[model samples]
Target: MQTLEGMIAPKFSLKNEVGEIISLDNFAGKKYVVLYFYPKDSTTSCTTEACDFRDSHEAFTALNAVILGVSADDEKAHTKFIKKYGLPFSLLIDDTHEVSEAYGVWRLKKMFGKEFMGIERSTFLIDPTGTVIKEWRKIKVGGHVEEALDTLKKL
Candidate 1:
């Protein structure tokens, strides 16, 4: 896993769920970011995690933070996933896994004895200055929003 704290996050310009190009520079000088990398959209664990962030959208807004979910899935899939779950935040389509690799969440995994490259669920808290302040790798879905919010509140 990449250690992100105190380091500059790699910049990215990716398609969001609405098929709009959302770039890291778009958030600069505007909002802090809760940038989360999840395995896939609409999966059980991913759904729970997305919903948690959705439920806390108001709180995040209050803190001037925008939540962005990223996955290897494409924009259409992300759009469907967002509509299905009423996800309040933007979901970035990392089709090439470039951003995932930059964040070091894309990894080799084994499931049912089949090994493949997949995203390791993770979250990064980026301050308004665009520096990473906190990072959670191999994240547990339960109560994760609270944990992230707690750190944001302190900031």
Candidate 2:
């Protein structure tokens, strides 16, 4: 697992579900960020994780943290997912996997004896200065958002 704590985060520019561009530079020197990369939208684990963050969105915002979700899913899928779950944060599109590759979350995987390429669920907590304060790779959904929130409290 790659731990980027105390390092400058890899910069990325991706369109959100609304087709508006969002980038690392947008948050730099403004607010801390909870940047999470999930494998897909509306799936079991992914939904759970997204909703967890949704449930705690106000808490994060209160701490001057911005929540952003990333996946290979396109704008249409993200739109549906956001509507279905009432996701309060932005979901960025990484259809080309560029941002995922930059974050090292793009990887190989095996399921039921089948090998495939996909994203490894991960999260990064970037401070206002674009420094990675904490990262969770191959994250388990349970309590993960709260943990991220707790980490932000320290910042």
Candidate 3:
């Protein structure tokens, strides 16, 4: 994967669960963007990660951060997942995998001895200036939200 730290995040405008267009520029000078890419919605790991973020939503908001989850899932799926989990943030649809490819999170993977293309669970912390300040690739879900919060605290 390519390094994105210290570089301006690739621009993207995707529809959220409510079909509202959300662009990288929307938060450009206001909030730090936590752009996380997961393989799918409603899966085991994805649910955990999303819940973790949901549980810490206020903490992130206090620090001027906005969490935006991305996946190839459609709006209906995203809407269901968010409502089921009471997620306070937006889940963007990247149904074409265009944003995933730009972020270098779309890749070939092997599961059950079969290879396929999918998202590698990853997170990018983009500051209000739009520069990616930190990134975690192929990440474990446990304690990740806290880690991201801690990084923001240190900043």
Candidate 4:
């Protein structure tokens, strides 16, 4: 896998829960981006992570940071997930997994004794200048949002 810290984040444009086109360029020079890639929508761990981010949304916004969740799930799934969880931030549709691939989060994995390709839980913190300042891969959901928030506070 390639290291992303201290490097420019890969650019991407994809539909959000509302079917609105969202791009990395949209937040450039405006806010720090917490770009997170997860395995699926509405799954246990995914939901926990999303809700954690949602609960901390205001804090992140106050710090000039925007949270964006990405998954291979489509817009409909994202919409349901967002509405069900009352998520304030956008959940992006990464149907092609291209964005995931660029971020080095898409990979081969094993579950239930079977091997498959999927997204590895990951997060990237990108500064307003578009450079990735920190990255977390294969992350556990517990306390993850707080960790990200702490990192942003020190920035």
Which 10 consecutive positions of candidate 3 have the poorest summed lDDT? Answer: 1-10
Please, what are the lDDT tens digits per residue for candidate 2 over residues 101-143?
9889999989999999999999999999999989999899999
Query: What lDDT tens digits, residue by residue, belong to model 1 across residues 12-121?
Result: 89988778999888988889989999998889999999999999999999999999999988878888998998988899989899899999998998899999999999
- Poorest 10 consecutive residues of model 2 by lDDT? 1-10
Over 1-155, each residue of candidate 3 has an lDDT whose tens digit, in order, gives: 66999999999999999999999999989999999999999999999999999999999999999999999999999999999999999999998999999999999999999999999999999999999999999999999989999999999
Cα shift from native, residue 60, model 2 (Å): 0.1
How far residue 143's Cα lies from its native spot in candidate 4, in Å, is 0.7
What would the C-alpha RMSD of candidate 1 be, to one decimal place? 0.9
Per-model lDDT: 0.91, 0.94, 0.95, 0.95
lDDT score for residue 146 of model 3: 92
Better of 2 and 3 by TM-score: 3
Q: What is candidate 3's local distance difference test score?
A: 0.95
Model 4 lDDT tens row, 1-155: 97899999999999998889999999988999999999999999999999999999999999999999999998889989988999999999888888999999989999999999999999999999999999999999999999999999999
Which candidate gets the maximum lDDT versus the true structure? 3
The 10 consecutive residues of candidate 1 with the worst lDDT sum are 1-10
For each candidate in turn, the TM-score is 0.97, 0.98, 0.98, 0.98
Where in model 4 is the C-alpha error above 4 Å? none
